[model samples]
Target: MQHQAFLDLRTTLDLLKANGELSEVSGEVNWDVELGAVTREVLRRRGPALLFSNITGYRGPQARCSRLATGLFASFRRISLMLGFDQQPSNRALIEYVLKKNATLVPPVLVEDGPVHENVLTGDAVDLFAFPAPRWHHLDGGRYIGTMGCVVTRDPQTRQVNVGLYRSMIVDRNRMGTLIVSSQGWGGHWGKYREMKRPMPVAFVFGWDPVMEFVAGSPIPATICEYDVMGGYRGAPVPLVKCRTVELEVPAAAELVVEGTISDDPATYAPEGPFGEYTGHVSEIATPRPVVKVSAITHRDRPIFRGTLEGSLPGASGENSYMSSIQRAAIACNVLRNAGIPGILDVFVHPVNNGTTVIVQIKKHYEGQPKQIAAALWGSNASSHRYKFVVVVDDDIDPGDYEAVDWAINYRVDPGSDDIVVFRSTFGSALDPSTLLEHRQLSELGAGLWNRMLIDATRTWRFPRRPQWGGERFPPLVTPRPQDLELVRKRWREYGFAGWKAEF
Candidate 1:
């Protein structure tokens, strides 16, 4: 079967509709908390994508012209469809597939015109509140307009553009505040601008091609441009068009683009968040962050606003963190493979675990190999500092299977004997609530310091019961014999078992 490119938000929605994966809510909805409530319910149910045609509150052109969409990439089936896959594969399979396909780089193509320029608001006419930006959670400080969006910025020295998925909260008609962790790429860019005492030009894209959303949220290497990885996913260059006010460029078919400049002055900082974050917890405290002064608001006529429920609810659905975990796993796997780590079979990063806690499956060839693998993972860029737990298992154990992993940890691991390496006061995720401000230690990069643990769950020795039973002679797993299991699997359907298919 031939596949189609999910080039733009409209195209992706159309595909979803055609596949009966989209749900339309035509009744009038409020932007304050009603929309978020509904979106939360839908996501909790693992329901279809929502397209709200009518929005209440605003009485201008935006009321009639703007719409809202949520749950765009909420399910495995939706993700598979977006990636142009023939069948919905297991999470591990999908990650491996994406890693392999993304190997081929495809640069973006510049375009003169696109649908995003159908209507443009520049200079004094720019208004950040033109659309129905949802107050996603009741406890959120304000309506966030850039939850499912990408913040585009360029480095001052390198001039290399970095597209990051930072939540932007609308503060006023022409200003918005966005969180920038000191360790993130955008933070690095802003840090340079702060050092230079110059405002950093930024473009916030609310609705663009679905591929852009995925790439923006991905942990792409700082050296490789996100657009290039986006192109690789699309199997072609992502079409781009120059922004109206900013020096940056945006996806040509973007639904809404907010061009602005992030003030570098510390005095310009605004109280940013008390918002319910992806960690599924509302930070009791808010912090002062740089605010973006909108210079332009460009979009297609009758544009749709895309939003995501970022807090704990989506995490419970198991859909929210899937992509991030997959991408992080791929990065970890690549790091290990490139370092000449042998017998590496698979890698799975637990999604709900704050994108930390990586599980590695490897073929055990020698003693102390699992410890080496764990150490390599801990030292690598993909896992170092970021990942909190590293668990190494044998190839037979599926990394994606938590139950299997648990069994391996319980049986193969000895807390005292097996290596459980711990590195103290290392850089860690700021979102980790465990790192209290009072007890927090800061790295030079401003990352919070925390301890990381590595568990070597892989079999370390063959039969230690006897010296004669040595070398590649480990006791076999207690289960049905391979040939016996195969025979039973092959004829299971003939035995008249219900829902017993060969593949399952």
Candidate 2:
């Protein structure tokens, strides 16, 4: 598919509107739990991306920023459009497109300055609350300013630039407390900074084209810069401008840019979390984490703050859920290929689990292939927060279909056989409520622990071949012959089920 560049939020919104995928909520809406609740309802209904203009506390003429955008990726259609598809594409198509684009890296082009520098606020003049950062959940610790922020940072030694989607909450006008998992891309940078005992320079790009959020939020390999990947998606180099207060570059026309430095100093840490997470639960506790020492705030005039209601609830999934489904599956497949593992036909991640469970469909090349898939995934950085439950099925099964997977798991998997494997006490998501509290302690363990599981739902090769079953190791699936199905199709009304309007 040809790529179309929508470099900024304004143009992206225009595209969304033109495609009838956007909705402008001109009526006054509260930025508290109310807006979040409304957004959830829309997500449940699979509605359009919202442009909230008349927020209750942010609509005044003197308001620093009055508009906000959310739910741009609540559906496959929106994500498909972002990928330059004229219409909604199947998950396989989406994954294939992403795999190709990820390999096509084009580094960003830096200009002297851009619209992000149109207005700059520093020192006492800076007020993070001036923008309509929302307390998306009632239990949220504070107004999260960086729900969708594409955080930009670099390694001190290698100078390798990284852009990631890490959550940040407003602690004060100039201080934002954030969670930086040691297993993530930004966390790797934080570790080096800790060793050197220096503050880590950080730049938060709050809003831009949807692709920024797409790549930043996924595991796109640490060696490849996200900006380069973004450029590849746009079919051109991303225009960038140097941040005023940090040695970082942000998209030139980003809606808002928050520049800061985070010290490893324990004294500067602040309490954060108890917010809704993508796993469909509230982060259990408020723990003191690294806080950003905001040095400056730069943006275009009347900037629109970007954030998302993070949790994916029953029948109400959020942006991260939709985006992760395609990217994580593609990334997982890529990981297996890179590891030289064979017969990885396709991979699928259910939106609800947000990549926690990766379903693999393979051509069944050899015995113990399921264990190999689980091992490779668990050993990869892409499995930091996901791939906790890896299910392997034969090529006949559709990984995307829960029913087919369930059927395969029931029949193909022998309960007492070597079809199930569990790797205990491995690194995983700290916010997983199922994990014991003691195991989830970041202060002590530096990361959470999970007992990962692998279910080999493929037909077992251990079974003896039988001539009665057509010389197969396992019995073939029971179904009517092709001639019988065609006969029924020709005489459908005779079966007295013509009221059911479907092909035989």
TM-scores for all predictions: 0.89, 0.97
Question: Per-residue lDDT for 140 in model 2?
Answer: 90
In candidate 2, which residue pairs get closer than 3 Å at backbone N, Cα or C atoms, i.e. clash?
A: none
Q: Any runs in candidate 1 off by more than 4 Å, and if so which?
A: 1-3, 58-65, 312-315, 380-386, 439-445, 462-477, 480-504
The local distance difference test score of each candidate is 0.77, 0.90
Candidate 1, residues 116-174, lDDT tens digits: the string is: 99988877777777888888788999988888879889999998888888888888889
Q: What TM-score does model 2 achieve against the real structure?
A: 0.97
Candidate 2 per-residue lDDT over residues 302-389, each given as its tens digit? 8988989898787899999999999999999999999899998889998888999999999988998889999999999999989999
RMSD of 1: 3.9
Number of the top candidate by lDDT? 2
**RMSD for each model, in Å, please?**
3.9, 1.5
Top model number, TM-score? 2
* Clash count, one per candidate: 0, 0
For residue 304, what is the lDDT in candidate 2? Answer: 88
